[model samples]
Target: MIGAMWKGMSGIYQQDRGIAVESNNLANSSTVGHKKDQITFADLLYTNGGMGHGVGSQSVSKQFQQGQIVGTGVGIDVALEGKGFMVVRSRENPDEIFYTRAGNLVQAKDGFLVNQDDYKMQGLVPQSRLTSSTNPADTMFTDEFARNIVSTNISNSLGRIFNINAKTTDYASSAKNDDIAQKGDNYKSSQSKINDVDALREDYINKLKEYQLTPNVPEISSQAQKSQVDFSSKISSLTSEDNKLSITVGNKTFSVEFDHDGNINQDEMEKLYNFLDDSGREKYGLIDPSSIPTQDDIDNMPITTPEEIQAKADRQSLRDNSINAYSSAKSLVKAMQDLSDKISAYAGYSSSAKSGTLEIEGLIQGKEFKISEVELNNEKINSTNIQEAIKGSGMAMIDSAKEALKQAVEKADAKYLEITNVLDYADLNTIGMTDLNVRLDVLGLADKDVADVEISDDGFIFVKSGDNKFLVGRLSTASFRNEQGLNPAGGNLYSQTDLSGNPFNADTMNTIKGKSLERANVDYGTTLTQIMVYQKAFEANSKSITTSDEFLQTAIGLIK
Candidate 1:
C-alpha cells in the first residue's frame, strides 16, 4: 500500500513538471532564434516487492531546430537563416558570456554589440598582424575589407549617422554628420617615441627616397606623332603656401603648388594652375563645359600622334612596323639564299665557252651561259654580285639589289599606315593624345570609385554619391539560427545565444533586397499544433492525479 502511494505521489509530481516545461516552450514560440523544448519524463526506481514503474520528474529538452528570417529595414537588426548561436553577455552584468536564442537586442549606451536583454554580444575581433599572433586583433583587414560601405544615402530626411570603424582602439558614434565614413575613431600610429633605431632608419630611408626621387628624370612620353599641346606635368602641394591648383583639366584633376605666400610663379605655374577656376569648375556642377584641352587642341602640337608626322618619317616604321617589316623581309630571305647559291656557281665558271650544255641560273659579265655546274674554288668573290642574283636572279648582284629596295619601300608604306594607326591611339605621346588615363587619375578616380556606400555628411552625400558611376547597392545577406530563440526586440533584431551560435554577418551575401529585412521562420500552423498537444498533456496529467488521490482514499478507508 505504501509503494502504491509513493508511485502515485511521484506521478503527480511528474505531471506538474511536464506542464511547466510545455508552458515555457509555448511562451517562447515567438522569440527570435528560440529553440523549441521537448518534454521528457523519467520512471522512478522502486525497491518494493515486484516494484512497478513509477513516474519521476518531467524535463524539457531544447531542440536545435533552425528558424526562418523576417526582413526588416533596420541595419542593426540581424537574423540567421541558417544554424548558429549568438553569444550574448549576461543581463545582470554584460561582461559574463552567456548563450541564448532570444534575439532580443538593444544598442547599449556603450558602442560594443548588445541585445534587448542588455546583454553584451561577443564576436571574434578581426585578427591583426600589427605585430604577429593568431589573436583576432592581430588580424589585419584585407583590401577588400577596407571597401567603403555606404548603408544609405541621406534623403531630405536627415538622421543620426554612426561611423564605426574597427581600425581604432575606440568606437565613436556620431548623431548626425555629413560624412559618416570619415567619422570613425581616428587611428594614429603607436605613440611610443621614435627611438634611435627608428629615427636613424627613418632618416636613412628619407635619404634613399631623395636619391630615388629623380625629380629631373625625363618623363616617359607616350605621345604619338601629330599630337598638339604636348601635355606635361606640374608639381604642387596645398600646404606649401601655394594656391594649390587642384585643377581638373579634362574630366581629370591635378594639384600643383607654388610658394609660402600662397602664390605661384606666374611664368612657370600659371598655365597649370590659374587656368582652372577655384570653385571646382570641372569636378563640381558649378561649371558649364568642363574638361579643358578639347580634342581640337591635340591636333596642332609636338604632342600629336606619330601618324600625324608619318609624312616627316624618313628611316623606317615604329615598333610594330619594324617588327613586321623584319618578318616580311624574313619570308624573302630563303628565296634570296637560293638565288645566291645559283649565282655563285654561275660566277665561278660561265658556260665555260662550252655550249657543253650548262643551265644558267643567272647571266653575268655580259655573257649569257648555261650552268656548267660550277664549283667553289676556295677563292673569294665579290659579295655584290651574289646580292644581285638574289634580287632578280639575273644581272650582277648590285643591279638586282637596286630593284629589291623599290619593292621594299612600296610594301612598307602601306603596312606602316595600318599598324601605326592603332598603336597611335594608345601612345601617350601622340599629337592628339587625350591622356585618358591621366584624366581619370586627376579626377579622383581612387576616392570617387566605390562599391557599397553610405552618406552621412550634410546634404553633400546624396548629391555626391550620384555623381560617380557606382553600382546600386552592394549585394549582401545575413544568417542566423533558431528564430524562436531570437528575442525580436523592437527592430527586427535578435540577440545572440549559446544555442543559436554567432551571427554570420552578411556583407553582400550575394543576396538581393538591400534596405530590407528577412522574415522570421516561425510556422504559425505548427506552433498551434504544439499548443494543442501541450493542453491535452496537461489535462491528462491532471486526471491521473485526481484518480490516484481517490484510489488512495478508498484504500485508506478499507484499511480502517
Candidate 2:
C-alpha cells in the first residue's frame, strides 16, 4: 500500500508537469517564430523484475517544426522559408551574439538595422571601408561578427554591420567634375558639385549628350558649274567687221554675228527680239512689245526741215548701229541677253548681263552639265577666270568644318567613356548588408530620401529614391549542422553551443519572403487534447492515493 501510494504521488507530479508544458504551448500558439514544446514521460525506476516504480517527466524539448508564413505587407518584415536563422548581435552587449528566425526588422535612429529587441543584425560588407578603396572583393568575412559596429579603431577583417548614412558628396571630387567639364564648353566654367546619386547620373548623361554629334554638311544631290565673264566689255573692243560670239549648252549651240559697220545684224536682232516676245507670251501669257523699239516705228516719225531730217537720220543710224548701248559705251548687252535666253531653254542654267559683265549659273546642285565652249571674236577665254574651275576652294571650307565637328565628338566620347568606366567599377565593387542606411551609403544614395523599399527573392534589398533605385544591402542568414543542440537564450533567440557547432552560411535552397513573418508552430487543438489527457491521468493518480489512504484507515480500525 505504501509503495502504491508513492507511485501515485510520482505519477501526480509527472502529470502536472505534462499539463504545464501543454499549457505553455497553447499560450504561445500565436507567437511569431515560436516553436512548440513537447514533454516526454518515462518510468522512474524498475524493481521486482521489470515492475515500474512510478511515472516521471523525462524531458521538454522544442519541436522545431516549420511555422506558417503570414504576410504583413511591411517593408522590413522577412520570413525564412527553409532551415536557417537570421544572425544578430545584442545592442546591450556587443560581444554577445544570438540567432533568431524572427525578421521584424526596423531602422534605428542611428541608421542601423535591428530586430524588435533592438538587436543589431549581422551581414557582410564591401571589402574596403565605404569611404576608401575603389576596388573591393566579393568574399566572406573571416570573423563571424558584422563590421557595422561604430568604433574608433579600424579592424583588419572585412566583415562589418551596415551603416547607410553616406551621400554622393562623399565620393564627389573636383577631378571627376573636370572630366565632365572637358566634354563641352557650356560646362567648362560651371563646375557643379554632385549632391546625390541622381544628380551624379544626370551630370554624366548631360555630358554624354554633348558628344552625340550629327554631321551637318549640306547634301549635294547633283554636280553644278558656274561661270562669270565681262562679255559686254570685251565685245565693245571688237575692231573686226566679223565679230562673232558663240556658246554651246548640252546639244545646242547659239551664235551672234556683227555686220561690217560693227553693228549687230538688223535682221538677226529683230528676229531675236520677236522670239523673246513670243516666248514671254507663251510662258507668262503676256507679250512685251515695248521692251524693244521696232524699225517700222522709227521710219514712220515725221520731219520738219532738212536739218531736223538730217538730225533724225543720224539718231536713227546710231540707234540701229549701237543697239542703244549704255552711256554710248556700245556694250553688247542686248546681244548677250538674247543669246542667254536661247541657251537657258536648252540647258538647266540661267544667265544675266549687267554693267558689261555676263554671269551664268547651273540651276541643279549636282547634275553634270557644262558650258562646253565659249568664244569671243575668235579668241578662247581662259577656264581659270570662271568660278566653277576653282570650286575646290569652297569644298575645302566645308571639309574644314567637318573635321572640327569630328574632333569635338571624339573628345567628348572619350571623356564619356572614362566616366562610364568609373561608374562600372563602383557598381562592381559595391557590397550588400542588412542595414538600409549602410547599403545606401555604399551605393552613394544616402542623401536622397527613400521612396520605397523592396526585398528580392534572392535576398537583395533595394530602395527607391526619387526616380532611381539603389541596392541597399542583402539579408544574411546562418545555418547550423545540429540545430536541435542550440541553447535557448529566451525571447525567441538561440546561442551556439559545442553540440550545435558554429554558424555557417546557409544552404542555397533557403530563401526569404519579404513583408511576411513566420507564425508559432504550436497547434492549439493538439495542445488542448493533451491537456485533457493529463487532467484524466492526474485524477486517476489522486484516486489511487485516496484508495490507499482508505485501505490504511480500514487496517488501523481493524487492529484497534
Candidate 3:
C-alpha cells in the first residue's frame, strides 16, 4: 500500500512537469522565431515482473520545424526561407557569436547594421577590388561575381567576417594615387567649362530677346506738299488732251486714260484697282481687302469733302482710297499714296498717308526693303527722291549669337555625358572593397547624402547615396548538421553545442526573404489539447493516492 502511494506521488510529479511544458508552449505561441518544446515520459526501475515504477518526465527537446513566413513590408526585416540561421556577434564581446531567425534589424547611429540588442550582423566583403581597365579581357565586377565572392569567403567561425558599415568619406587614397588625382582634375576642368558656357548661353539669350523687341524699322517717304491747288482748274489742266497715267506694282501693270471733258475712264480705273488688290493678296497672303478697317469704318460713317465726288468719281471706288484730287499738290500726293499702298501690300510693307506725306515701311522690326522701280507719266523717279534703306545691325547680331549658343550647348552636353561615364566606371571598380570609407573615397562621394539602405533576396547590402548605389557587403548565414541539438538561448537565438557540429555556410537552397519575418511554430490547438490530457492524468494519480490511503485505513481499523 505504501509503495502504491509512492508510485502515485511520482506520477503526480511527472504530470505536473508535463503540464508546465505544454503551458510554456501555449504562452509562446505568438513569439517570433519561437519553437515549441515537447516532453517525453518513461517508466523508472523495472522489476522482475512486468510491472514497473511510476512514470516520470524523461526529456524535453525543441522541435526545429519550419514556421509560417509572413510579409511585414519593412525594408530591414528579413526571413530565412529554408534551413539556416543569420549570424550575429555580441557588440560588447566580439568573440561571442550567436545564430538567429529573427531578422528585425536596425541601422545604428555609428553606421553599422545591428539588431534591437545592438548585436552586429556578420558580413563578407570581396577578396580584392576590381581594376578600372579599358581592355576587353579585364574581369569586371558583376552581380554574379559579387555573389560568388561572398560565398567563397564564408567560414564556420567569424574568422575574417566583419560588421557592415555605411559611413561615407571623400577622396579615398589608393596605391594609384596619381591616376585618381589626374582623373579628379579632369572632372573639375570639365565642370568649370560647363559653367562658363552656361553663362555665355544665358547672355546670348538675353541679347536675342532685346534685339527682337527693338526692331530697325526701315521707312521711305515722298517730300511734303508745297501748297494747295484749285480742284476744277487742276482737273481741267491735267485733262487738257486726255492725259494717260500708267502704274506698275510688282510684275503687274495697269493704265488709266482721262476723257477730253476731264472725266476718267471708270472701266479702266476699276481694272487697275482690281489688279493691285489681287496681286497684293497673292504676294503677301494678306486677309481680304474688304476685311481691312478704314478711317471711315473707325468713324462709323463716310467722310466727304465738297470736291470728293469729282476727285474720287464715285463713293464705291473711294471707300478705301486716301486720294483727293482738289489741287495739283493734292493730286500728286494722292498719286503717291496710291502707289505706296499698292507696293506695300504686294511686298509685305506698311504704308500710310499722313500730314500730306506718303510713307512705306518694312514689316519686320530689324529688316530693310527698297522700292525696285517707280515711274510716273513715262518718266522714272530718281532713287534719291526716296529715303535710303536702314541696315539691320541688330538682326545680324542676333543670328550670329544664336549659332554660337547652339554650339556651346552641344559641347556642354557632350562633356556632361563623358563625365557621367567616367564616374560610372570608377564606381564599378571600387564597389566590392571591404572598407566602406575607402569605397566612398575612391568614388569621390564621401560627402554625399545616403538615400536608402536595402537588403536583397540574395543577401546583398545596397546603399543608395546621392545619384549612385554602392554594393557595401553581403549578409552571412550559417547552418548546423543537427539543428535540433542546438541550445536555445534567450531572445530567439541559438548556440552551437558538441551534439550540433560547428556551423558552416548555409547551402544554396537556403535564401533570404527581405521585408518579411517567420512566425513561431507553436500550435495553439495541439498545446491546449495536451494541457487537458495532463490535467486529467494528474487527477487520476491523486485519486489513486486517496484510494490507497483508504485501503490502509480499512486494514488498520480491522486489526484494531
Candidate 4:
C-alpha cells in the first residue's frame, strides 16, 4: 500500500509539471520567433521483477522546427527563412555573444545596429578601413573621391589666380579706383601666397593620378563633344541666291540679300525688304526685320574701346598661358574615356565568345570556340575578317580581350601623371573646362548623416544620403549542427552549449532581407489538448491515492 501510494504521488507530480509546460507554450504562442516547448515523461526505476514504476518528468525540450515567415514591410527588419540565427553581442558586455532568430533591429544612439534588447548585432567590419582588401568597387570609389577633391581644389585655385592677375593688370595700367594702392598692396601679398601653393601643384596632380582617377574621363569627353554646337546644319539650311540670304525658322522661309557695294544691289535689298513686309513676316512675329542690320546701323556701331581691347588682350594672354594645361587635361580625359570604351567592348566580346554551349563528356572536337563560327550574318566580310585578324586560337579570345583592356587602362594611367607636370608649368591656366559630373554613386562623404538604410539578401548593409550610397557593413548569420541543443538565454536569444557544435556562418541562401519576420511555431490546438490530457491524468493519480487511503481506513476499522 505504501509503495502504491508513493507511485501515485510521483505520477501526480509529473503530470502537474506536464500541465505547466503546456500552459507556458500556450502563453507564448503569439511571441515573434518563438519556438514551442515539449515535455517528455519517462517511467521511473522499478524495484522488483514484474512491477512497474510511476511516470516521472524526463526532460523539457525545444522544437527547433521552422517558424512562419511573414512580411512586415520595414527596411531593417530581417527574418531567417531557414536554419540560422543572427549573431549578436551584448552591448554592455561585448565578450558575451548570443544567437537569435528575433530580428527586431534598430540603430542605437551610437549608430550600432541593435536588437530590441539593445544587444549589438555582429557584422563584418566596414570595407573602407581595409585598404588592402580586394574589393574592386571600393578601390574604384576611393580613387574617384580622391581625384574629385584634388580637381576641385585645382579648379578653384586656378580661378583665383586668374582673377588676381586681371585685377593687378588693371591696377598697373590705370589708377582709376580709389582703393588701387591698397589693392596693390593686398595683391602683392596674395600673389606671393598663390605662388607658394602653385609650387605644390605638381604634387597634387601626381597624387590625383596615383589614385587612377579615369572612370569619368570618357563620359566628360562625350558631353563636351555634344556641347560643341554644329554650325554646318544651320549653314546647310540657308538658301542664298545672287546676294540674298534666305533662312527658315519653323514653317516660314524668308530670303534677303545684302548689296553693300553701294550699287544697283541697293535696289534689290530694298525690294527684298518690301517683299518681307508685304508677307507680314515682322507683324506675325515670324522674324524681326528691324533686328537685321541696316547700312546705317552697321556704320553707326561704336568701334572697340581701349578698355574692351585691353580686356580682349588680357583674355588672349590668359588663354595663351593656359592652353597647354587645358589641352593636357582634355587629352587625359579623352584617353581614359577611349580606354574605358575599348574595355567595355572587349568585355562584351569575350562574354559572347564564351557563351556558346559545349558538350562536357564528348570526344575531342576540332576548332573549339571559333569566333568565326559565331555570326550575325554569313556574308559580312568585316565580321568574318575580325576573327581571322585576331592572332590566336579561338580559346584565347577572352584572354586576349582581358589583356587589351588591362593595357589600355594602364596606358591611360601613365598619361594621367603627365598631366600634373603640364599643369605645374601652365601658371595662368583657368579651369574653363566643363564639369565632368561623373556620377560615382558608391562614394560617401564622412560626417554626413545617413538618409536611409537598406539590407540586401546577400547580407550587405548600405546607407544612403542624397546621391551618396555607402557600404556600411555585412550582416552575419550563425548556424549550428544541433540546433535543439541551443539553450534559451532569455530575451529571445540562444546560448551555445557543449551539446551543440560550434556555430559557423549560415549558408548564404538562408538569409532574406526587407521588412520580414518569423512568427512563433507554437500550435494552440495541440497545446490545449495536451493540457486537457495532463489534467485528467493528474485527477486519476489523486483518485488512486484516495482509494489507497480508503482501503487502509477499512482495514484499521476491521482490526478494531
Candidate 5:
C-alpha cells in the first residue's frame, strides 16, 4: 500500500506538469507567435524479470499549427499569411531576437520600425534604389537649355537693331548726294546737267526747260570762261547716275529697297530707319527675353527719345520682319537644346510633336487589399465603410470578410492547380502575373464579384474558404533539445538543442492555414487525456512493488 501510494504520487506529479502546460496556453491565447505544449509519458520499468519502476512524464512537445491573426487594420498588425514565425525582440531589450507569432509592428519615435516585442525587423531596405534612366543633373541642365534659347534670341534681336543705327549714316550720305545734284551742281545758267536723266529730279528740270521755257544749257563761249564767272558743263558729271537706297521702316519688311531713280525722300527714309530701330528695342525688350536675373529693367527699356517715336511706323515693321527670319531660327535651335536636356534627365518623360507624356512606374507597400468582392456580414469592409457602418448599424459599412475569405481560398486553389499542371513552371510571363494586383478598395466587400479561393506557398496554404476559420492550418510540428542552446541571448525562445541538431522552419506539405489565424493547439482535452495515462502506469508499477513486499512478509511469517 505504501509502494502504491508513492507510485500514485508520481503520477500526480506528471498530471501536474500537464496542468502547467494547459495554464500556459490559456495565459497566452492572445500572445503573438505562441505555441502550445503536449505531454506524453514512458513507463520507467516493464512487467518482466525483476521489480519495475513507476511511470514518468517523458516528452513535452509542441504543435506548430497556424495561429489566427486577427485583422486590426493597423499597419503594425502583421499576420503570417502562410508559414514562419515573426522573429521579434523583447520590449526590454530589443537587441535579442525571439521566434514568435506576434507581428504587431509600429514605427519608433526616431523612425525605425519595431515589432510587438520591439524587435527591429531585418531587411532595412526592401528594394535597392531604383536604377532610373535619368540623372538629377541632367534635369537641371534641360531647364537651363530652355532658358538659353530665349537669351540667344534676345541678343540676336539686339544686334539687328544696332546695325540699323549704324546704317543711318550711310543713308544720310546718299541723300546728300541727291540734294547736291538737284541744286544744279553750281549757282546758274546752262544748268541742264542739274539732275540725272534716270532720276525724278532730272525729269522735273527737263520739263521746266522744254515746255515751261526754264533756262537751257546754252553753249558757253571762250569769253564766258575769261570773265570772272565760270559757266561749265561740270553739272552733268556731278549728276552721273547711281542707284539710291530706300529704307522702308514699318511698311512690311525690315527692308532696304533700292531703285535706279531718286524717287525716295531722304528725310522720310531717315525717319523710317530711326523708327524701325527704336521700335525694335521696345518690342525686343517686351519679348520675354532670357531668364537672366542679371538684366537691368531700366537699361533694356525701349524708346526714350521723341525722334524714335516719330519713326515708329517704320520701326514696327522692321521688328515684325526680324521675328520671322533670324529670330525664328534662333528660337528653334534653343527649343531643341532645351528638349534634349530635359529628355536626358526625366526618365518618365517622352516627347512627340503630338504631345509629350510622362509615365512613372513605382510600387508602394501595405496598401490595403480586400479579400472579397461581395458584401456580407454587418461589418464594414474598408476604412470609409467603417465610419458609416459604425454610425448607422454600429459599423462603417457592409463587412464582406466571409466573401473575402472565400476568394482567398479560391485563389490559392487555382494557383496550386496551375502550378502542379505545369510541373516545372519557371517563366513568369506565361502566367500573366503582371496584373497580379490585389486591391483593398473597400473594407467590407468590393462592388466587383470575386470567387472563393485558396493561396498556397512553399511553407503552407491559406484555407480562406467560406468563413470556416476554426479548422484553418494543417501544420507539421517538431521540437529540439535545449531550445536555449541555439545561441544568442534569449527572448524566451529556445533554438534547436545541441542534442537535437540544426533547427529549420517547415509547414504542412498539403495543408491549409486559417486565412487569418488558428486557435492555439494546446487543448485542455488533450491534457486531461495525458493525466489518465500517467495515473494508470504509475498504479501498475506500485502494485508490482507492493506484491514483492507482500510475498517477502508471508515468507518471514512461515519461517517463524
Candidate 6:
C-alpha cells in the first residue's frame, strides 16, 4: 500500500512537471523569438514482472521550427527567417554576449547601436567619418564661371569696336588730305590769273609805243583793229582749251563751256573748280560739302583737327580694350573649363566621358557601392534635359548652370533615396543603398541629429539622424551546430553551453528583416488533452493506493 502511495506521488510529481512545461509555453506565446518547450516522460525501473515503479519526468526540449514572417515597414524591426540569432552584448556588462532572434534596434543616446533591451549589437566597427561625393558646390562654382564669361564677352566686343575706330580715323585723315589738295589747286589758279593780267599789261604797252611812233589816227585805228582781231582769236583758243579741261573725274563727267571772248571767265572757272572739288571730296567720304573748306580756305584747313585726332586715339584705345577683352575672354573660358573639370570631380562627374552618364558611387558601412546610371525607381535620366535648363545670357546662363547642377544632384538623390540593403537576386545592379544620415546629413548637407534606426533582412543597420540617414553597421548573425542544446537565458536570449555547439555565421538566405517574430510552438489543445490524461493517470494511481488501504483494513477487521 505504501509502495502504491509512493508510486501515486511520483506520478503526480511528473504530471505537475508536464503541466508546468505546457504552462510556460503558453505564457511565452506572445514573446518575440520565443521557442516552445515540450516535456518528455520515461517509465521508472520495473519492480515486479509486469509492473513499473512510476513515471520519471524526462528532458524538456524546445521546438526550433520557423514561424510565419510578417513585414513591418519600420527600418529597425529586424527578424530572423529560418535559423540564426543576432549577437548582442549588454551595455551594462560589455563582456557578456547573448544571442537573440529579435532584431528591434535603435541608437542609444551615446550613439551605440542597441536593441530593445539596450543590448549593443555586435558587428564590424562603423566608419567614423564619411564624405559623400555628391555635387553640392556646383551652383556656386557655375555662377562664378558665368560671371567670368560675361566679362570675356564684353572684352571681345570692345576689341571689335577698336578695329572699327581705327578705320574711322583713316577715313578722317583722307578727308583732310583731300581738303589740302583742293587748296593747292585754288592757289595755282590764282597764280595763273595774275600772270595772264601781267601779260595783258605788256601787250598794251607795246601797242601804245606803236601808236606814239606813227602819230597818225589811221595807223592807230588799223593797229587797234588788228589787235582786236588777234584778241578775238586768243579768246576762241582760251574758250576751246577751257572746254577740254572739263573731264571725267570719278563716275561722272561735266563740261564748263567758257564764253568766246574771255579774260579768264570767272564764272566758267568757278564752275569747273566747284565740280572737281565736290567730286574729290565725295571720293574721300567728305559728303558734307558745308564741312569741307573752299579752295580759298583749303591751305589752312585739316580733315581732322586736334580734337578729332584725340577722338581717333580714344577709339584706338577702345580697340586696344577690345583686344584686351578678347584675351580676357580666352583666359576666362580656359578658367571656366578648368573649373568645370574641378566641379565635375567634386560632384563625382567625369567630364572625359562623351556620354552624359556619370558613375555615382558611395560607401555604406565601409563598403563601396556603385550605380551605373543616375536614376531612381527604374527611371533613366536624360542629360539633354539637364543641359537644356542651362540656357540664355551671362546671368541667365548662371541660373541655367545651377539648374543643371541641381539635376545632377537629383541623379545622386535618385540613386540612393531610400534605405535599401537587401541583396536582390533579380537585379544585381540594384544592390546599392543609403541610410538616413548618409543621405540627408552627409550627402544632402543636412545638420539634423539622428531620429531613428533600421535594420534590413540582410543585417544592414541604418540610423536616421534628424531626418537624415547613415549606414552605421551590419548586424552579425550566429548559428549554433546544436541549437537544441542551447541554454535559455532570460529576456528572449540564449547562451551557449558545453552541450550546445559554438555559434558560427548564419547564411544570409535564411535571414529576413522587417518581419514578425516566430510564434511559440506550443499547441494549447494538445496540452489540454495531455493534462486530462495526466489527471486520469493520477486518479487511477490514487485509486490503487486507496483499494490497497481498504483491503488491509478489512483483513485487520476479520482478524479482530
Q: In candidate 3, residue 245 scores what lDDT?
A: 39
**Global lDDT scores for all candidate models:** 0.32, 0.54, 0.52, 0.45, 0.30, 0.43
Compose the digit string of candidate 2's lDDT tens values, residues 1-560: 88889999998999999999888888888878988888898887798798789987777787778899999998778888988888888778778888898877777766567878888877643333332211123111112111111111111122222222111112223213333312211121112222222232332233223222312333232234666654543544565456677876556677777532434445544433443334222322222324435577667766888987886787577555346332222225445555554444332345544323445654433233455567778676532225442212222332222222222222222111110001111221322223334344434433433346666555555565433344455677778888888888888899999989977777353778888899998887888999999999999999999999998889899999
Best of the two (1, 6) by TM-score = 6
Q: Residue 437 CA error for candidate 3 (Å)?
A: 11
Model 3, residue 497: C-alpha shift (Å): 0.8
Looking at candidate 3, the ten consecutive residues that score lowest on lDDT are 415-424
Per-residue accuracy of model 1 over 1-560 as CA lDDT, tens digit each: 45555665666566656656556656665666565556677776656775666776554545555565565554345554444444554557545444444443343443333656565555322111112111333332223223221111111111112111111111111112212221111101121111211222232233223323332333221111110110111111112332222211123222323332322222323222232234212221212222223233434435267865662242222322333322322212222222222222221111110111111222221122222222112111111122122111111222222222222222212110000000111111211201111111122222232232321111011112222221111111234555444443332234556665545543222222222333334456765676576567557656666777788789899999
Tens-place lDDT per residue, model 6, 1-560, is 56776787788788778778777877887676778788888988996698888889879987787755566676667778877787888767666778887665666666566767887777632333322212333211111121111000011211110000000011111211112223212111222222322332233233333333432232111100000000111111332122221211122322223222222223433332343334332322222323323334433334378986665555555444433333322222222223223322321122211111221111001112222232212233222212211112322222223233223323322111112121212222221222212233332223334446666555555544432234445656677788889988878788888888777767443766553445555567876787677677767766777887887788789999
Q: After aligning candidate 3 to the native by TM-score, how far in Å is the CA of 378 from where it should be?
A: 46
State the lDDT of candidate 4 residue by residue for 1-560, as single tens digits.
Answer: 77778889999999999999988888877777888888999888877796877888788988877888888887777788877888888767767888888877786655667889988877653322222111233322322332211221111222110000000111112222222222211112222223322222332234334223321221110000000111111222222222322222123332323221312233433333343333222221222223334445444545489876665555555443333222222222222222222221221111110101100110011112222221111211111211222222221221232233222222222111110101121221221111111112322323343446666565555554444344455566778888888999988899999888888767443856557788888877888899999999999999999998888888899999
Q: Each model's TM-score?
A: 0.33, 0.48, 0.47, 0.48, 0.34, 0.46
Ordered from best to worst lDDT, the candidate numbers read 2, 3, 4, 6, 1, 5
Off by over 4 Å in 2: 128-444, 448-453
Q: What is residue 126's positional error in candidate 4, in angstroms?
A: 3.7
Best by lDDT: 2
Q: What lDDT tens digits, residue by residue, belong to model 5 across residues 410-481?
A: 222211000000011222222111111111111111122222322222212121212211111112222233
Off by over 4 Å in 5: 47-51, 89-96, 131-496, 499-519, 523-560
Residue-wise lDDT of candidate 3 within 1-560, one digit each (tens)?
A: 88789999999999999999999888887777778899999998988897678887788898878888899887777888888888788878777888888888887666677776877777654443423222323232222111110111111122222121111111111111122222211112333334434444454445445544554533222111121111122233454444543444335553444433323233433322343334322322323334434445455543487575444445444433422221223343344444444433332233433323334443222234433344444444433224433333353554344334333333333211100111111121121212222133333323433346667776766655443445556677778899888998878788899999988767354778878888888888888899999999999999999999999999999999
Winner on TM-score between 2 and 4 is 2
lDDT of 6 at 157: 17
